[model samples]
Target: MSATAPTETQDLAPVRTESLAELLIATERPPRPSALSACLTFGWRAMLKIKHVPEQLFDVTAFPIMMVLMYTYLFGGALAGSPQEYIQYLLPGILVMSVVMITMYTGVSVNTDIEKGVFDRFRTLPIWRPSTMVGYLLGDALRYAIASVVILTVGLIMGFRPDGGLLGVVGGIAVLLVFSFAFSWIWTMFGLLLRTEKSVMGVSMMVIFPLTFLSDIFVKPETMPGWLQAFVNNNPITHVSSAVRALMDGTSPTTELMWTLGWVVLLVGVFGPVTMRLYNRK
Candidate 1:
């Protein structure tokens, strides 16, 4: 009998089923988290990682100390006439260098995450795509802050002083953090474009070392050859170092600070898009 002629209610049951299916889908979908919240959550993840693996902090801790000592003693007498004199100039420059060098670790970490298929899990989640990178960028700022403190504390122990007072020191620290976050996009690009973490680390060092060492970090750029001096004068790191130096010394950092901030805009503007493109492709 049913085969012969199903009632209208029976015939429409499939439609009702389809409607409920759509309803289920509509209700089951979760709301997206705000971009800022997502970033902070991910930033928290990074901070927790530091807690579990305290050794992850070795670079920020040990490197800054080594650099402060090595540069202070190795070149102090010849360059600034004494370790004490050099520490003032050297500390600021080294603060910038320390933060810059540590930025590479972000790239390596990204690559490692990708290699392990961790990001595949991230993609399946409903969050802002850029948030992960932003999270890393923000979280690394904490690391940068740690490094800055390490450097400054070590410097103070070694008879270094910041004439800019606590305010200058605080201001310089803030700038270093902003600069580190901006510069990290370059390493993020490296992480995305490269296949392995080791390669990212290698390329990062190759680029970062020359920029840090060849600039006015440890000595006067005028002592460099004319050709070298020209490049050093234009180097973005040179501006960062100059700004940090001025800020820490209580001098007006307007000109150098402006230049350094400009570089921050440029780096983020250029690398930000490239990083996202490569990130999506990955």
Candidate 2:
């Protein structure tokens, strides 16, 4: 009988099996740690920029300090009790405002990246897909944290004391930072959607100005007319400001924190997806 035809494997006998080392080397790369690594790298870069520039820290730190002193020394008696008492009352609100202002840096940063074509380069890199947007937000959170600390330190120097103790102060700052992160997402969307940094600042000012004025920032919401009062009462900033005040005053848990967090969840849920979408388009 004729010998059976060689099997397919025998026909391909010249092929060499890969060594374990080669196999491991050629193995598919591990899944991208897009969010984590990107956040870390981008955040580290932000810190580095802050360290190098030094001047950028001025807006976040000095501006808030000046605002506190101006309000306390100039308008303190007109608005409330003595400057010391006003400092006590206003520091928390000012801190919240400081964090809110700090969030604008997110847009400024994005604009800078766009101008420098940094984001374009990012597209060429095999980075974690989620890192682009997550990295930005993470970087901003770090910046905001630093600004908040500096602002709080200045407030302390100016005789503003938080009666809630060290833990309370920590919690107060934490609350404001979380609120700022949530707020930053909204601005991030605006920044991404806009073509210029100045436009981002202008539009943001228009959007936030009314909200800030109507909230309990410079005055008690209850002191306003009914319509304004209703709006102020419903504003998320009002709740955040009130919650921060309560925390600074060493008061018990209030509905304001709960409300503020609820809004934070809602905004993050909405804008988190928006950021991902816009980031992908870029």
TM-score of 2: 0.85
Model 1, residue 237: displacement in angstroms? 0.7
Cα-based lDDT at residue 17, candidate 1: 79
Q: lDDT for model 2, on a 0 to 1 scale?
A: 0.80
Which regions in candidate 2 have their CA more than 4 angstroms from the true location? 1-31
Off-target runs (Cα >4 Å) in candidate 1 are: 1-29
Clash pairs (backbone) in predicted model 2: none
The lowest-lDDT stretch of 10 consecutive residues in candidate 2 is: 9-18
Clashing pairs in 1: none
Q: Provide the overall lDDT of each model, using Cα atoms, as 2-decimal numbers.
A: 0.90, 0.80
Per-residue alpha-carbon lDDT of candidate 1 for residues 55-151, written as tens digits (9 for 90 to 100):
9999999989999999899999998899999898889999999899999999988898899998889888889989999988888888999999999
TM-score of 1: 0.90
Model 2: per-residue Cα lDDT over 168-271, one tens digit each: 88888888878887888887787788899999899888877787777888888767889899899999888888998888789975699899999999999998
Give each prediction's root-mean-square deviation over alpha carbons. Answer: 7.2, 10.3
Compare the candidates by lDDT and give the number of the best one.
Answer: 1
